[model samples]
Target: MTFDKNSFSLAGKVALITGGARGIGQFYSIALSKYGADIFVVSASQKGWEDTTQKVEANGQKVAFLQQDITNPDAADDIVAAAVAEFGHLDILINNAGVQLRNDVLDFKDEDWRSVIDVNLNGLYYLSHAAAKVMAKQQHGKIINIGSMQSYRAGKRIFPYTASKHAVMGLTKAYADALAPYHIQVNGLAPGYISTEMTKPLQEDPVRGPEIAAHIPSGDWGQPEQLMGPMVFLASEASDYVTGVMLPVDGGYLLR
Candidate 1:
């Protein structure tokens, strides 16, 4: 039997990406669109929607936008419905929206911790659950959760974000196991020492910056564009046999 040479082609597919209006999520939207998938971007703010729209359109693919915060569990259903309405069906869901807070273990406030978990873990679950329902009925879907190196290791003053990511790892596995029979693939993408706007402070740290760079065998932080290829693989038919796997595009940052 011949295998599909075009397995990576996402033509005619549609993706709903949370936080797709900016940062890494914006890159996700553009990458998928570049690879022939129509994009339905969802975000809490419209700050970057215009730029995202222009990029997606420049790729010659359809693009739609929705302003909805993923943190509202009740709105998850509506978000799913709107995506389906906009594109007829949802083929991929990228749970890339997240939040981070830093404080000493003792100084970390109760609400501060909750805010991190609320967006990173709880919101991801609500949206994934809603998207899985649609995929279950359609008999196929891809859910990519954004995880971090913290999923495997912990650091100071960031316990809440770490906790959320660790839970995200487990949730990815659980969702994979449960959705496999439905032809839905769930996976995690963990980034290590990625140089993005979100991590600008860490990159600029006089002491902490060099410390992390030295530890990364690659001798540098990863860029958002470096992740696009992996994202396309996970979202396309190329990865039909791959599920529950966490792909790291960290430029060997985890090796050290």
Candidate 2:
């Protein structure tokens, strides 16, 4: 078999990334643009959008920034419409928007649990559902769902986060099966203990921090940059035949 490097080029493609502003999301916006995809970033807040825009423009890519909460059911269609209007078509969708909360399973408040599920699960479904309609018409698209280490196993003080991620894996497979015939690929990317602003609390924790590092075979937390390659592969034609798979970019943390 022959491998073609050109298959990985995302030139002339349009990607809509949710939560494509701060932390790890910033890396995704930059990485995808670097590989030649125009970006439509939908962030909950406009805080870091200017920085993300500069990074994307530096790579010679066009990017549109939108500030809206995805948790609202009606916000999905509007978000997709805005992206389509900006870029004309949506070729790839990175479902990178999510939230996490820490609480003892027994002490987890109803509101906190619902909040996590709202953004992590419900909001994801809303946007993916909207994107699916547009992509189905074109008979081609890629959807990458961002998952977590808790997607495979349990995490301390984060039961709701764990529960929502498990559901994301299920939705990934279900969407893949439903959209495969249309040439739409749906997949999940699970990151393990990546060091980022959102994960700072865990990374700096005196107890949970070192405990997590010890579990990873690499013996350290993963960096946001490490996830960039896998994201590009999935978004580009390189993963055209891959679907319904949850790829972990962890440093062998699950091996133990």
Per-candidate TM-score against the hidden true structure:
0.97, 0.97
For model 2, the superposed segments whose C-alpha errors exceed 4 Å read 1-3
- Report the C-alpha lDDT of model 1 over 1-256, residue by residue, as the tens digit: 2358688889999999989989998899999999899998888889898899899999999999888877775889999999999889999999999888889988889999888999999999999999999999999999999999898888688889999999999999999999999999999999878888878998899999999999888688888898898999999998999999888777787776
Best by lDDT: 2
Per residue, candidate 2 scores C-alpha lDDT tens digits across 55-98 of 99999999999989998769999999999999899999999988
Q: What RMSD value applies to candidate 2?
A: 1.3
- Residues forming the 10-long window of minimal summed lDDT in candidate 1: 1-10
- How many residue pairs clash in each candidate at the backbone level? 0, 0
Q: lDDT scores for all predictions?
A: 0.91, 0.92
Every model: Cα RMSD to truth: 1.1, 1.3
